[model samples]
Target: MVSERSSKEFFAVTLRVWRQAGPSASGRFVDYPATNVSPDMSFLELLDVVNDGLTVKDEEPIAFAHDCREGICGTCSCTINGKPHGPGHGIATCQLYMRSFKDGDTIIVEPFRARAFPLVKDLVTDRSAFDRIQQAGGFISVRTGAAPDANSIPVPKDDADLAMDAATCIGCGACVAACKNASAMLFVAAKVSHLGLMPQGQPERDKRVLAMVQAMDEAGFGNCTNQYECSAVCPKLITHDFIARMNRDYVKALFKAKFKPVSSASGGAG
Candidate 1:
């Protein structure tokens, strides 16, 4: 990547930013010319330049969420050019670069469209629904004690690998945005499978899955139609396989509840 500080070459592009005053306010696309944009600059950096121009003109800068431009924080989420993370596979929005677009290209930026993710401002949405869903059952309760050896508990290599894969989900809500129904099954499934596959997670496996699914429903997210759009835009590349696994678990739990015999006691000598 060539540095703008060292290179004299700068290109121009147009940014179609979505502007919404508030959650209930009607939104519109506002075009801003980004002149002298360095090809080496990240997508967020380009926005920074545009915002600086807006600020200089005594205009409100575009409000967007970004934290760790290194692509790990998962906060730099935006629907770029009709794709999450901007025309890339297995990468977050922060990982997108200006070079990905040609000079004079028009880039459309918008927030993740979902009922659960209400618009907070221009490009920022209240994604706290994910946090609430996580809080429901995304944990394993265990006594805190001295650190145990890594191999103390025997775990199959495949299960460990799958758990790690599922754990890679950063809860960015990209899956929700990409789904036609705005389903969060992929996200919830990832969280459920990540813990359900591990030995430490065994104690609360049944309770965890049921609670998390209920929380997700209460969050106003739609149901999965098996379109697999959620997996397509996931920055972590979380597979849809977890969704099937979670469905199986949920069905099994239902059957278990239906068949469990109720205990009856008789008071003798009363």
Candidate 2:
């Protein structure tokens, strides 16, 4: 648990932020002193203060991504001192508070590094790779008609609860950043399982698993060796067990696709 600091207490830290002009431009860490920082201030808020100082000095301010300052939107992604989403569990960078650090700390901030998530500028990375992967499968087609009653499709309580856990993934790409192999298995698995477990998703389960895994490989993400680091830094606290579930689904799908008649495989394998 994080200990609370006094409301009147203020501290200072050296912000070591990465600076880059473009995708191909050179980049380096530039340090700036952040003074009069309140413990209650969010990490992004501290960056805002630093940027304000830079703007006033006729210097280009730091670039970082953020939306819906609440942790719901995973747009605010960055590495702080080599940890994805900074020093906290189940919290995105936007949700990290200044109190997590000590006074006089040198905070190192940089973009999430991975071949799939190319760096844009400073702390921003192009995480649209996740979008492409999602577009490949991460959904179920529904008939365009009146909405069905919730109780019409009764799901087991256990399955419903597990599906909701997987659905919490916000596509932050923190898993890719945290893994030594830069594997996106956890992200793909969560996407696959959340929908695959539902009755509506059964029709395309095999297809979805195959397509998403293929897309993940094509996006240049490495294979998961099961080091389990991906789950270690996930802001959503998504478990690695989802990866196992996805792997089983992929194997079953592949086996059926190879042996079953094409016509018979249309509705997907068990």
Candidate 3:
């Protein structure tokens, strides 16, 4: 990745955006120009211009999901210019800048393509598969009225730090998108670790990892090959180490639950 330097005519970027109509529809890249774009404009704002251009041309505008236009929602997920969350460390695509490109640069944007992420529209995919995995018991099942003080339970600082690291997952799906096999290893492991680190998550304990991993497999997500690409592009910068931890948890879960996780071609989702 070479740095492009210019202070003039930053607009006129060539955008190659994937256009998908629906779940059953196959998508293709379409070119649109980013006219009058300023360097300071957020990447999505620049896309807004492009969409407006297409709408004026009476062509269907490319539909990309975004809200709060801030990076935190994790909903503004897109694979920008072949990089998940665009060109930088730990930044969402919405936080990317037009300055990352120069005039006449061709930018490619696409939805997160994973079997788990079934394309819902142009740049929006159904990530509820992740939600389902969470619902499969990623939580501590305490009745609502059982509110305890923030420090009710004393979690060791080391464990707390690790849990916080795992909890940093924004559910952006970048890990799934970046992997060659579209493995959701990082995402699943984060959830597993986030819960496994604390005492509150003890009730479900072994069952949580087992069930979530099973759901991940059934959702058609590929197994992690240890290539580490998923962790590399993760917006939260979650590491493959979490996957290793998850495997250990899963192995423990197998004995505790009395049900073994099915080992497929790639060693059962890493």
Give the number of the best model, judged by lDDT: 2
lDDT of 2 by residue, 47-67 (tens): 999999999999999999999
Question: What's the CA error at residue 248 for candidate 3, in Å?
Answer: 0.4
Residue 152, candidate 1: C-alpha displacement in angstroms: 2.1
**lDDT score for residue 106 of model 1:** 93
**Candidate 2, backbone clash total:** 0
Best by TM-score: 2
**Which ranking of candidates, highest TM-score first?**
2, 1, 3
Off by over 4 Å in 3: 1-9, 259-270
Q: Write the per-residue lDDT of candidate 3 for residues 60-85, one digit (tens) a residue.
A: 88888788766777888889878788
Candidate 3, number of clashes: 0
The residue-level lDDT of candidate 3 at 47 comes to 83
When 2 and 3 are scored with lDDT, the better candidate is 2
Clashing pairs in 1: none
